[model samples]
Target: MDGSRTAALLGVVLLVTACGQPAREPGPTGCAGGVPSCAPSTAPPSTAPTTPAPSRPVTVLRGTVQAGVEAGCLVLATDRGRFLLLGGDPTVLREGAEVVVEGATRPGQATTCQEGTPFSVSAARAEPATTR
Candidate 1:
């Protein structure tokens, strides 16, 4: 046989041998022996329920009430910082009133008033007058 004929016969034999073999099943590592570096996963999924963090405590602020630049916006100027009061007694939250307010500071709360931290007022009272 010529060299070409022998090479053709050898190629046909190799193809036939490869086609007759069964495919290998993947190991527990999800990789066939085709990859030598794969390892099986050992960590298990967690089943415990997760608890939410507690809410923040309410804040008390003492300051003189002042109206914001925008109409209907009330602001309190305290030593701590300025606070925009929301949902308090209209009489107690009047402009120029010296008052003590109890509420939570809602930094994320949206408002038309551009000044001061947004405060949701639960209660408010005017400061008692003092004799000189």
Candidate 2:
């Protein structure tokens, strides 16, 4: 072949060879001497137990138990605010009862009671009646 034809054939051969080769992935940066440990991890995530988050602090509230707009729902009208009482002694949670309750406010909790913030009552006691 003439020199121009030979050069054109060589360039075509090189281009085909390069196209057939697999692509090389970039290595992880900041590795010391390309160590195996320095490569990006492919191992499954850890299954070991982790420390639990801290519990919310309990609150004390004094209020009068009132019937909610919805049936079977009890609410406490306190000085701070009204609380939708959940899971407490039925006797102490009766309507028109004056009570002191210990619990935590659960703002994100879902409930049918439309009024008051949600309060999960841990304990409750009725206030003794006093004569003036």
Candidate 3:
């Protein structure tokens, strides 16, 4: 075939191949999503929906009320762990006494309290020794 005809045939072939392929849209950067890729995609943006704050109480730890010897505050020690009492009557809730206390956690509750997470005691009850 002539040079011009051959060039025309090649141009048509290239155009047909390009038309057969699907078009793709640019995708978001992978670094922000940690996907490790930036390949072109037609999909929508990936995102996590915003969540609301919880309405209920944070914690309700069960432990025996112990005297805060080092910190001079009240402390509750249970199998879970130990926590310093923020506001509660330490008179009846004496050391070695089993009690169930419920309250929300207080971050940086008291500087003097030691060896326990700061916990605000909202409701508390002394249990019978027989239950132990």
Candidate 4:
């Protein structure tokens, strides 16, 4: 074959061999196609979810029966702050006694303690001076 033809054939063989060869180590800058810059990461960035704080502070109320009225059988006291208990729960407790009430509270029947407006207890337990 002619010299020029032989050179052309050799060039084609080299190109084909290079394309068929296995990949080499990535270049210094990473896979930015010869550009000295790092390739974009496939992994996503991490983030944390936000949480809400508590609504209102707990109302831990406690106090003594300041007064008791038999009108509707109600007792008034200054619990955590100020409270008025409703009807004397025969199954629960009575007047002039220490009591521990819990749960959402509101005003009860009218009594001398607070005048018809008494603190209501969702639950009440009379604390006796002496255990019976």
Against the true structure, what is each candidate's TM-score? 0.57, 0.62, 0.50, 0.35
Query: Candidate 4, residues 1-132: lDDT per residue as tens digits?
Result: 999999999888866766675655564435423222344456656577768874433233444555444454454455245555654454554556566665444443445554434444566677754557
For model 3, the run of ten residues with the poorest summed lDDT: 29-38
For model 2, what is the alpha-carbon lDDT of residue 27? Answer: 45
Q: Can you tell me which runs of candidate 1 are displaced by over 4 Å? A: 1-53, 129-132
Q: Give all candidates' CA lDDT scores.
A: 0.85, 0.86, 0.72, 0.53
Question: Which 10 consecutive positions of candidate 4 have the poorest summed lDDT?
Answer: 31-40
- On a 0 to 100 scale, what is the lDDT of residue 121 in model 1? 93
Rank the models by TM-score, top first: 2, 1, 3, 4
Per-residue lDDT of 7-121 in model 2, one digit per residue for the tens?
A: 9998888667756755545444654432333556466788999999988899999989999999999999989999999999997799999999998999999999988999999
User: What TM-score does candidate 1 reach?
Assistant: 0.57
lDDT score at residue 34, model 3, on the 0-100 scale:
22
Per residue, candidate 3 scores C-alpha lDDT tens digits across 68-110 of 8674677888787888877766654678878878788776666
> Using TM-score as the measure, which candidate wins?
2
